[model samples]
Target: MSTLTKQDTFQSLLDSASSSFAPIRTQAKETYLTQGLPALKEEEYKFTSIAKKLESKIQEFKSALPFAVSKEDIESVLFEGFDGDVLVFSNGKYLPELSTSPEGITVSSLSQAENTPLGSIAKPEKDAFSALNLASFSDGLFISVPKKQKVEKPILLISFNQANSGQVIQPRVWIEAGDFSEVTFIDHSISQTEDPYFVNKVVEIKGGLNSHVNYYRLQNESKNAIEVSNIHTDIFQDSRFTSVNLSLSGDMVRNNLTLNLLGSNSEGNMYGVYLLNGKTHVDNHTNVDHTIPHAESNELYKGILADQSRGVFNGKIFVRQDAQKTNAFQQNNNILLSEDAIVNTKPQLEIWADDVKCSHGCTVGQLDEEALFYLKARGIDKNTATGLLLYAFAGEVLEKIEEESFRSYAISLIQERLGSKF
Candidate 1:
């Protein structure tokens, strides 16, 4: 028998499972084996060495160290007095005792939900990480909203992970909104341990015709946390889909967000704010596709980097040939506070339609020296003046948040982060 190397251990995770979705996983396993992990030189992943980071965590994953999360652990990270359904997932398993589902919506595990849109929106074969997740993920969420129903309260998903040794955790979530339905979600992640973690998560959503959906994801993890997350959403005819991604802290975090406007008169919106300090790295990659006529999309992402941190933003908007009369726009702006801080930004637009209007651009610079002098002339201290300026800059995205409570909460978080930086 041959000795099993670390690579073999990583591949072993793709083993077929005994379940109804066995065939899907089996095919994904084959795809993962053939494609393997991505190389650093790959265009899509050129800036982030996610494959290397995953490999570094595989040894701890193979060790299978005993790990568990307590309710007190959940309490430490809970949003104070959040008024809504909150579901808790520790490691890779959902903890019902620490969760509460809303009254009207259908909430259940992925395996237990009927007529699930599990693999419909996510393409495992097209992406290596998706293939890896589809093959090995043990638990996930399946949330279904009935047709024409409007949820009164939002859903808050809390993914918390902790352990003594380095660990890896994957969480999957699927959401389906029926025609004319309206719902909102807050997907927040937290890591409360000093040990490093490779948190891999995939979230897929399907919006029915004329439905309304809003998704806000926040990542605030420990300094040793490494995360790779993909969120894919599809909006149908006359529907509206909006999302905001907020990253406060992490060692290495990569977020891939994809929005597909599949029907006429559909609208999609993307907004984000990433605040980095220390040696943290956060990459935000977004793709928006207009597949039909009369579609519109808008994207804005801003970042404030201090210390020796790094930030990356790559956004691509596509207007297909059939997507006539499409209006698409994207902009990414960054403010570097320190000489050692770095940012790589690229905003791209590909339009095949003759009657479409699309544009993309980016900006990177330090704080305005004249503005600082203007503030100091009024007796404002340097640090306070800097914090106020950054808050105003990042607040552009935060102002787009519609939910009153969440908007307030997000504003507070951003203000606190900016205040501590200076």
Candidate 2:
């Protein structure tokens, strides 16, 4: 009746979690309480002070739960003309009423799923945000694709954040693919909230033998939204895992993407594009590990910054001793349109294998004045010429997208985003 202390509130929240995953909850809670939130000193989080930011709005986050939602509110964030199968979440609560799944794919509530692979690849002990999501997520979705099945349509996961201006939302999703299955998954996040909000989201994927998984993530939150997202995937033997991340708009956003190639002949491809303007700041961090022989990985990320926006990209590749004949390549390129725009890029490689081919490089520079002038000299206007040149630089990553419909949608998004800038 008087007051709910922080410990009391946290305990109450944990006690109310689904008992099916109580052990995992207990472990995650321990990790969250022990390691606590990341600090600026940690090399992994030096650029992004997410822990400090989240701590400041902890109470506002507590009040975000039981967040009210209306039908019209969730519909606003749906991607235009893309109606395959959508699983919608408003403020981290799965809305089954507005969600749908294809034939070969099975989707269910996470809390009720039996023998769930909740914390398999993304262990809570490793990351503070992962620990918090595993500890506090009241509900989420668990999806599975059967062995030897091919899902013709891509699955859409829409994370829509609304109201609760200063609230914090944690969305957790677990996806598993059986041996020889093929599927594509897409993640789109948006905010209809006015004031700044925080989102700590984690999505873990487990790929099966000889499976193919294509994951595409789009970040286009509101002007004042802050988000930290982690996507960790484990690819099995003879599997192919490709991930494309597009960061368009956000106040401050950080993405931690990791791919573990634990089996032979497994391939991982990473492609990203970030277009920033105004005071927006976005960071993309990627790690790919090759632990077995005859595996390959390729990564490329491009960014175009205008106004006073800032961008950071760090890509790391590791080829272990046993990973003979591994092929790994990573590169990041950026273009600045204004004097105040800035980019920091670091591409690193650590190889312990004698017979591996590995290379990493990064470049940060302004637009090619010659190229812009060349186009302008011809009948093209200055603005159009500049936009064309910028698109050419970023379009290479967009062309890496295989799916036709999604590729087109992504291209349109880029055009729309750049149109406002140039």
Candidate 3:
């Protein structure tokens, strides 16, 4: 048998899948071929070798359902005492029986939503991963918050990988918050597999005028897992959107977040915390685009790396010519626990509007030796002193989480990951 070409492999996969979006699949393949997987030389991907990793694992694509997960499995992953609408996807396949939505909120599979009036929302763009998700995704979550309605409880969308053997899964979620509506959403990616797995997930959020949306993403995969998550959000006039991302697992993880301020007087806040150990690698890339006048955006991301782990942070704020009075601020800070641990951080601001106020900065350093010594003089061990210093370094971002339960849970998780009590 002849070896399959890259195009042939992509085409064959597209053909074999029973997808409702044929055009998107074709477009994605074309984009991939044209762009040909971002190289390390690509300015945006200079420090990350994502394309190389994907190329190495491309041949692992196979036809097999490793394991079938049920609603019971989803129940096991839910945060205790959390009550709200739930959507569960196992190995990229949406399980309808496991999902529940409140009144005025519409939740369904992506395939089904593509046939409805909202189908236009799935238009293929230059984003190859998004296009690929549209084309090949077997199951995903579609959430629509009705106009003028406020969801009392947060919506929880959980994507779980329960395969007993190694496998790759891609999960997608699209959310639309209607005009004057308010809602909170949480996306959790959990893995119950012992074997190595790959998770490629994408989430798109659209906020209407005068609407408010809060988004939380928690990724806690196995240490051997690899994950790439892309989140795109568009906010309209006077809309408010906040996103909190917590990265705690996976051998390699990358988070790409983009916020489009399409209307005036809109506000956006992005906060992230990453704790890494061993040889774990975590990268976060964020872009805030101000297209209209009087927009505001603030971002803060902090990371703690131990045991030779590496972390990367790249944040950009863009103010368009018409975006007068735009105020954008971005900052990234990382604490290295070991000499071998590394952190690469860059924060940039590009403003075309003369009236805009924007600032970006980043810092990569070790725990303050003076502070450590002070703690040690007070009878605290080196490990405990380090943990306390690390906690304080990350506490700013963690404190920004408004939800009491979530904040406590995140702090506890961080403490556990640090393996020190203070």
The lDDT for every candidate, in the order shown, is: 0.82, 0.82, 0.77
Clashing pairs for predicted structure model 2, backbone only: none
Candidate 1 per-residue lDDT, tens place, 1-422, comes to 11222256455444433365677777777777777767776788788887676556545353223256677876666566567788888776677777886878888888887666465677776567777788777767888899999998888888777754445677889999999999989988777687776777889999999999999988888988888888999999999999999998988899989999999999999999999999999999999989999999999999999999999999999889999999999999999999999999999988888998888899999889889889989998888888888898998999888777778888888888777343
| Candidate 1 stretches greater than 4 Å from native | 1-6, 16-20, 56-60, 63-76, 164-166, 420-422
If both were scored by TM-score, which would come out higher, candidate 1 or candidate 3?
Answer: 1
Query: Native-vs-model 1 lDDT?
Result: 0.82
What TM-score should be assigned to candidate 2?
Answer: 0.92
True-vs-predicted CA distance for residue 189, candidate 3, Å: 1.1
Candidate 1 or 2, higher lDDT?
A: 1
The TM-score that candidate 3 achieves is: 0.92
**TM-scores for every candidate against the unseen true structure:** 0.94, 0.92, 0.92
Highest lDDT among the candidates is held by which one?
Answer: 1
By the lDDT metric, which is better: model 2 or model 3? 2
Model 1 TM-score, all chains together: 0.94
Per-residue lDDT of candidate 2, residues 287-308 (tens digit): 9999999999999999999999
What lDDT is obtained when candidate 2 is compared to the true structure? 0.82
> How far in Å is the alpha carbon of 27 misplaced in model 2?
1.0
